[model samples]
Every structure is written in structure tokens, then in C-alpha cells.
Target: MLLKPGRGFFFAIVLSSVAPVAGATALAVDPMTVLIREYSRGNGSYEYLNSGTDESYARYILDRPSSPYANIKWSLLPSPDTPTRRAIESVSTQEHPVNLRDLHDMKVWDLGFTKAHIASETFRMPQELRYVPGAWSIVKAGIEPDIYAQAIRNQGLEHPAMTANYALAAQLLRAKLAATPPSLWKIRGLRHDVLDRFVGGEFMLAHDFHYLIQFLDGALATWDAGSTSAYGFRQLPAPLRLGRIAAAYRQRLPFEHEPCMEDDTHDPEHAGEGTFDRRPLCFDDATDRAIHVWYAHELVQELAAIHDRANGAPTLAERMAAPLRSSRQGWIGIPRPSAIAEVTRIEVVEAKVTGQLLVEGDVSYRDAFGASRRALRLSCGMRP
Candidate 1:
């Protein structure tokens, strides 16, 4: 994902300073302090396991309740598979292989497939046909008087995994958009394609868009409340909200520019005679609209929610500066970023040992996108 050059630089500064010493404070007084400390320790454990040679040792350490490393080990468990293996298996073996064409032929409001075996297959359908597949196929197949009469009865059934895939794809997209920054260049095109597909009557893709919009609405509501509390505002401006929504959209889609070559030998059962296209979906005309659209919207909404919540209280700037006051000298500590970059200097702006610590810093970097842009600046402070 492309992040705006300025924001990326700012993020680098915050990460370097606030991120490093984020958990240094004792948790007895500050809840966030304690949470950070615990999380850090836990994160370290998983990092060790992931990078270490012994998987069994990692599992053993995680299994021990009283182990000092327990939290990390437990937290490090890999995310559960998005689509349950059982569900996928059920759909794959179902009597009828529900393909994209099937979904495009079903009736709108026909919820029978919700319990069907090929739930995941529903995701392959086009957007306009999402709710009323039968109507769509009739129109596309042409209204021959005789053929049209039986269209409703002949509508194809979709597999349960189709529904499951659509749901999962929507979820994954939301997460990506939320975690990524706005300057990521690919997001705009991705978002545009997602919206276009939905409005253009691509029903399967529209299902994804609908899901994304719903998710965004929920996230935005939470963010708005947070903003109201922190900034003393009744509501966020419409433009800001929309911008946030867009940002969230971009964040969810993964960096799929890298080519993916599939090896059928890895999964012999699913492998076929010809070479398969294993490439991750890139936002393009040829991309699968259902999957991509769902993902993009879901991601943007999530990111917007996060930014709204985080930006609500003691803005990042203010938070980063809290460690610098003279009175809080004893409580002052380093700031940490989520990631690291080249650092030039760290400064204490304010502090009150009896109160909180504020700190700031400067950082420099050539853009991650390799534009050769250099010497960016950022500031952050933490209070405890």
C-alpha cells in the first residue's frame, strides 16, 4: 500500500521514538502502560518462536500456564483459517459444483443457499445478480419466449462456500485498509474499481460493496463517538468522514503486485492438467470483482474506525510531547513507532514527574516507494 510521503515520514518519527519505550512505565497506575507492557512481552515471545528453529519448543513454552513466556506463546498462535476447511470440503464435494454462472442464475431474496453445501460458491456470482440471480441470467441469456418461461424454475443453486468466501473476503479487505496508510498509491485505483463494479450492476461485486459499506458505517460510528469525546465535537464533518472511509478502503487490499505462480503438485487433489494462475488479485479490469470489491471496502472502513478512535484523545502530536516536561522527568521515557526508520534526534518537550511525560523527535528517510525523496520530519510524545 502507498502511504502519503508526509504521513509516512511522520509515522516513522512516532514509531522510532514513542514505540520503543512505550511499555517502560509501570502498569500499577496507568492501564495503557500495563497493557503495553504485557503486549510487548507477549509479542516478544511470539517473535522468538516465529524466528526460532524449534516449533515444538515454542508450543511447549506456550502450553505452560505459569511460564514467564506463556503470554507470548499463546498470543502467537497463527490466525485460524478464514474459510473453515470443513466448509470448503463440503462445498467442493457437493453434487453440483456451484460456479460463477450458477450464482448469476439464482433468484434474489432466495435464501435457500444459506444452508446449502456450496456456500462459498456464492462469492463467484456477479454483483447485480447477488440478491436475484434468476432475473439477471434471464436478461443476459436473452428473453426467448419459451426459455424465459422456465427461467425462474431453472435457476441454479449456489454452494455455501460462496457465501462464506464473500464474507471472508469482505473481512480481509476491511482489515487491510485499516492497517495501511493513505499515501499508498494502489488504493485509489482499487477503491475506484470496487465502487464502479457495484454501481455498474456487477451483483457479486456489489455484495462485497454492500458488506464493506455496512462495516464502514459501524466503524465510522465508533470513530465519531471517539472524536466527539476527544475533540469536543458533536460530529465529524462529512468530508472528513468520507475521506476516512476511502482511506479505510485502500488499507484492506494487500500488495499483490508481486507475481504468484501456483504449483498444482502442492495440492494434487485440486491440481489440473494445465498450469493455473496463482497470482493474487491486482486491481484491474481482469480482476475478480467479487473478491476485490468486498476486500477493498471492508479494509477502508476498519482503518477509518481505528484512526477515528486513536485521533480522538490527546492527538498523536500531543501524546508524543507529554514526556518532556521537567516535573515529570522521572516518568519520561522513549517513544516507539510500530516500525523503525533512520533517526536523527530525540528531544524532551515537557514533563512533570508528578504527572506525565512529553517528548518529541526528528527522523529522516528516503521514501519506502523509492522515489528518492529524503529528509522528512515527525514528532510524537507519550504521557504516563
Candidate 2:
């Protein structure tokens, strides 16, 4: 699903609802601009740069209604070989001045342009129209299974690394559950090293394990907060409040007596060298960390369901079907596409059309003054 085209490649998204209108010609559109077109009307914002930074450009056309650059149509990715494309790409010898195309290679803000001129700068989406946050607030906006399911369905494909990490986590979870004297968790520093044998080379690949620690830290803090906290564990039935188990899992995740930085398993030079500082789980592996987090998250939900079964509380599967949301943080990212489309047919057409869609991205480009470059992060979508 990851598309990589030449410098100015076309990305077309055809949804089932708009399939008839889009016709056979898959609209060659920049996903980000499509989002801005859908939601950046009254939601856009504008802020001027510091003094001496294109006062004329800011004063004249920035927010003015008559300015074409301020218009969403003007902000779109111009069709190939068109006058608009030619004009925008003319001054710069580099890739098309399409917004956000140079994101990864952006220059630091402190280092201003080597040469400065108005014509020297390239055309990109203006800052005002690229501030769409509404797109992110939707997937979880509706009720259960609303947009959240669609997101995971679209974006949740697993790679080999992810699969291996999840397998490791599953093995560890199984071993932990089978350990003798389950009440050992009541003793804070007890070792649950049943699956420590798996903590070797392959385990080190999960670089994002710290996020699991972070989630555990939040769980502990919430539990400690008691009834006063908005997400207080005390609000839950006593059986569902897994405070001690979480603490034990946190303690057992790393070497209890060792410092994280000095842990040799995570250190490149000393990794898997059998150093005393080596941990059962390296806190830095991204895939491994995500598996651990997913494991722990689902474990807690299952435990809660088991405990609350008698009281007719929602089961783990029921909760899993619900959209991703939080009382404290509101909507969260879950569903993949956020906007869905069905491809009815494939045939070449010539006209441009906007279809229901959602795409979020960050674009880095130098300002019109050719001064410092900055990033524009936005979430754009047209919900079905």
C-alpha cells in the first residue's frame, strides 16, 4: 500500500460512494491537499513570521479572499504538464514545489538559506491552510466500531519483525501465567524469569519497549491516584483493579537492580554478551516493545472482563469492538484510512474530482523568504 512514485507522482484514492463520479480516471490528487479542501475552510489559521520575513507577502495575499494562493484549489497538487505545475516548478531546479515533498531532507531552522530572493523560493501549501487537526479527531468520534475498525483493517498489516516480536511476547505471557506460586506477585521483588530464555538476540529488536514502561508507569500512577483521579483505579470494582499485578509486571520487565542505561542487553557493543547488566527485555526495541504493550493491554482487558463477568460488565471482545477513545484525551488514532473508498472500475479519465478521503502528513519546506525551513503537520480527511 506504500506508494513511491517519481518526483511528482500521482496518488489516487477512489472510494465506492464516489466511484461513479470519479469514473474511470482515478483522480491524481495529493492526499493532504484533498483533506485541506474538505476541512480547512473556517478551520484554517494564520500567524505572521517575525519581522523582516516577507512583510509584503504576508500583508498582501496570505489571508486575503481574492488571493489564489489562499484558495484550496490553488493549494492542490497541479496536474502534470499543466501551466500551474510548470509555473510552480519553474524557478526551482529541484523536485516539484509540491507541499511536504521534501519533508525528510528539510534543513534546520537555525540555518537560513544560503541565498535569498523572492523568485528563489518555491510554491508550497501555505501555512494557514495546512493546520487541519479535525481529521485526527474523527476515527474515534462516532460510536462503537464507527471509524476505528476501518482504520485498523486498513493499517494493521504485520511484518516479519512484528510477528516475531509478538510470538516472543505470547510465549512470555504463557510462561508467566503457568508459573508456580502465582501469589508470588504479592512479594514486590519476586522474579518471574520463567521465559528469560527467550531474551536473547531476536528480543533486542524491539526498540520501543520504553513505551510499555511508560504505559505501566501511567497505570501505577493512576492506581496510586485512588478515587480522586478522573481515571482512578478505585472507580473500578476491586476485582478489576489489577494494581499489584501491573506493578509486578513492571518490576519483572527489566533487571530490578540494574540501571536502564547501563543494561548491556540494550547496549550495542555489549549486547547479548552475557553481561550481568543484561535485561530479560531490552527497553529499546520498537517491535518488541509494541508487542509487549499490546500483550499487556489485552491482558488487562481480559482480566477486567473475567473479574466483572458476574456483574454483567462488558467482556473483552465487546470492548475490543468499541472505538478507541479516552475520557481524558478525547479521540485517539486507530482506524487506518479514516476515509474509505471502493474501486468500482479502472479506466483513464481527464477531469479532476475530489472524493471522500482522509490522509495526515508532515511537510517541511523553506518559507517564501528562503529563510528558515519549517514543518507543516496536518490531518486531512473527507469522511464517508
Q: Which candidate is the best by TM-score?
A: 2
Q: Could you tell me how far off, in angstroms, the CA of residue 321 lies in candidate 1 after the best superposition? A: 52
lDDT of each: 0.22, 0.22
Model number with the top lDDT: 1
Report model 2's TM-score to 2 decimal places: 0.19
| Candidate 1 lDDT tens digits, 1-384 | 010111111121111100011111101122111212232233321221122212232232223322211211112222212222222233332444422212111210010001010122222433443443122222211122222222112211121111222222233243345556746627432243443332243433323434544443333222111111011111121112232222222323343342222320113232111212333221111111112222333322222232223545543222212221111111211132210111111111001110121111111111111111111222233211
Clashes of each: 73, 13
- The ten-residue window of minimal lDDT in model 1 covers 108-117
Query: Which lDDT value does model 1 have at 5?
Result: 19
TM-score of each: 0.17, 0.19
**Which digits, one per residue and each the tens of the lDDT, describe model 2 over residues 1-384?**
001122233332322111011111111223323222322222220111211222222222123322211211111222433322332233233433432322101110001110000111222323432232211111111111211222223212122112222222323233334564668643632233422322331232122232222232233222111121111101211111221112222323334443223321234332221212223222221111112232333333332332224467554333322211221111211231111010100000000111111112211121211111111111133211
Per-residue error for 116 in candidate 1, Å, reads 22
